[model samples]
Target: MVKLFNEPIILKCDHCGKDLFADSQMSIIVFVEDRKNKVIKDVYVCCKLECDRNLQEIKVKEGLIDGWKDLSDLTNPILFLNQIMATFNRMKNGWIFEPNAFEKLKEIYLACAQYVMREPTESEIKRASDILGLPF
Candidate 1:
């Protein structure tokens, strides 16, 4: 007998509206469960921390807390910036299956900006641009 996978026909990123390929390394899957209703809602997003953050925000707006890690832990600006660059470099070097490093970088950059309460400095932008070889 043969078995079949139950992949959804149309799985788009809950945060960025990007198409999510089944079982792809570039995809992040979140299963939110409601114990009272005994239902699980599957959330699919691209492999970016910003996407996860956005999903948590949306859930908070809806009064559902799934006990995700606190975003406040990323408050250290220098460390946060390092993480962004590392993730970007990995994606660019084909460590991750995603071809679009810009999307991932943009998401992380926006999150960093929000935390810092200011737009990215010219130097920061230039650094990222130099690494990715794309005009930021």
Candidate 2:
């Protein structure tokens, strides 16, 4: 998942297509498929918080609210990755992060690298290296 964010890519509101930047007050909702795969279903950016709430209600009514959570709550990288891989034996679409959320993904990858390097087994080191696409 090599996302090129070289330029200032303006993200849009998933519902209204309004221009949104990284610093905007936005809400990101991820949909988890069977507790194994996660996909960003929407990124709601609105001037009023009520608009974002309204959109979320609509999604709930449409049954698209399965395993949804606030992006801010995803603070634990290892736990987040574990949940994404809980039922799946192999990695899949859940491993991907939305382009706007690339910074968070980088942080998680870095955390994973640090974790695995802390008194890691040979095999664990290799696995982490492979996952991070780094030559260890």
Candidate 3:
């Protein structure tokens, strides 16, 4: 799959009639879920305030939580950015992750971020393994 942060798409909010997205800015994050209700995959975006509010309302109605992690974990934006970039590299290098691998990686980043706040421990390693789908 060719992942390019390209042009934007406009979508309306279920609550209000408004342009939810704009071109060349940010697109709406369209994420997919699996049969078991696990997040299968996700895509990021830039959207309008109404759309954000609408999504929150719907998720609230369904009692769903946005599991997206903080992307500001890594101090250096370049290295932090490389985390997602490396996933694609690994895919091309034959380390293609499972369908929901990116989501797991996001969790891994969160774990690492927490580790950065305290003494590193074995649990962090376990989390890393789990994110990579490796047996502990």
Candidate 4:
């Protein structure tokens, strides 16, 4: 009798909340860089249309595109707020991040410490709460 082999899960899909196996054809990796600190962050998602679109939207909204890459420096207020919301969403969805992910998250929060340390305005609170199902 032959025994079936099961692939190990490497990570979770940031969009669909699904387990990503070692060789999932649908897996895609996106990098979010904190150029000011020379740090690179990774975002994992499946290659489904909705998932891909959501990632693209986040990039666009965060202004991480080719010419606007400086927007991801973590100093921009909008970018900082968005990153915090994204982290929150990931935690809310029970994503088990790797160690480096934690380090990057720590770097991000530290870089934006001033913003976090201060009182958030009513507008900021409203905008942060308005996560329209985008997976960061």
Candidate 5:
């Protein structure tokens, strides 16, 4: 049994929803690697061992990831949102951040704060409510 150094949380199987343990015997380590053989992120994971084929072939559909997704398929809005979050975290953590990036994010935050501080006109409030998917 390989050292499952990471704590395992029992997950419900997607197919049958059976509570499966995340152990070396019952699970495989999912790893992600870059083109240079460096791991970036390990995404999808299933809590079922593949070696028990001969014991009892539980038709555990090959839902095993062992791979990654194409990031290029994401939309610009989603990318922008992710960038905003990452930038925010970087600044909060006090990392060596770019001055220009900090200024831009500060501007965005200031503009938003200013907008929220001022009392909006009825029409503006209505537009805001509609934009927030609220019933107003």
Candidate 6:
């Protein structure tokens, strides 16, 4: 497993709804794809080795892994969100004006708002709301 990020991120297992600390060794992130090679879903699991194996087998049987990706290391959501915001700001300031700019910025802003609102930490939610100028 490649270490993509050093900090831990909160995630919930799609199958069991169990809280998963992405920095934990037992955590697994799996991406499922259809036969045509389009990604369909992403599954996060924090479980024992046996459970991980079982999930892989089940997904294989369902033909959801024609070309799949598995990663143990994940980026912290807050950091990722901050990066997104920074990139959006840079683009807003540097890029030529486009008709879709408003829509694109709105999309990113709404994504940040939703993520912070759903975050488990109150501090994170409040800070993100304040930074994004969103009333939560």
Where does candidate 5 have its weakest 10-residue lDDT segment?
Answer: 67-76
TM-score of model number 5: 0.23
lDDT of residue 32 for candidate 2: 24
How much lDDT does candidate 5 score? 0.36
- What are the runs in model 3 whose C-alpha is more than 4 Å off? 1-37, 41-44, 59-61, 68-136
lDDT of 6 by residue, 1-136 (tens): 2211233334555456566443345655443444344333433343546656767776645656623222232244565466556546745655332334344334433433433444436686578678877765
- Expressed as tens digits, the lDDT of each residue in 12-48 for candidate 5 is 3333444433232343222232323332222222344
Q: What lDDT score goes with residue 6 in model 3? A: 28
For residues 82-125, what per-residue lDDT tens digits would candidate 3 score against the true structure?
65575567557554334454654554444333323444357865
lDDT ranking from best to worst?
A: 4, 1, 6, 2, 3, 5
Q: Residue 73's C-alpha lDDT in candidate 1?
A: 32
Error of 4 at 26 (Å): 1.4
TM-score (C-alpha) between model 1 and the true structure: 0.31
Can you rank all candidates by TM-score, best first?
6, 4, 2, 1, 3, 5
Q: List the residue pairs that clash in candidate 6.
A: none
lDDT of 1 by residue, 85-129 (tens): 765675465443223434443443454344444555778778877
Highest lDDT: which candidate? Answer: 4
Error (Å) of candidate 5 at residue 100 is: 3.9
Instruction: Write candidate 2's Cα lDDT for 26-136 as tens digits.
Output: 544334222333544333333235546666566544434434343322334565466446524323534444555445434333433332333556787678778987665
User: What local lDDT score does residue 96 receive in model 6, on the 0 to 100 scale?
Assistant: 32
TM-score of each: 0.31, 0.32, 0.27, 0.33, 0.23, 0.39
Candidate with the greatest TM-score versus the true structure: 6
Which of 2 and 4 is the better model by lDDT? 4
Model 6 quality (TM-score):
0.39
Instruction: Candidate 5: give the clashing pairs.
Output: none
- Which segments of candidate 1 are over 4 A away from where they belong? 1-10, 41-46, 60-136
lDDT (Cα, tens digit) per residue for candidate 4, span 73-117: 344567667767876786676555556757645643553444334
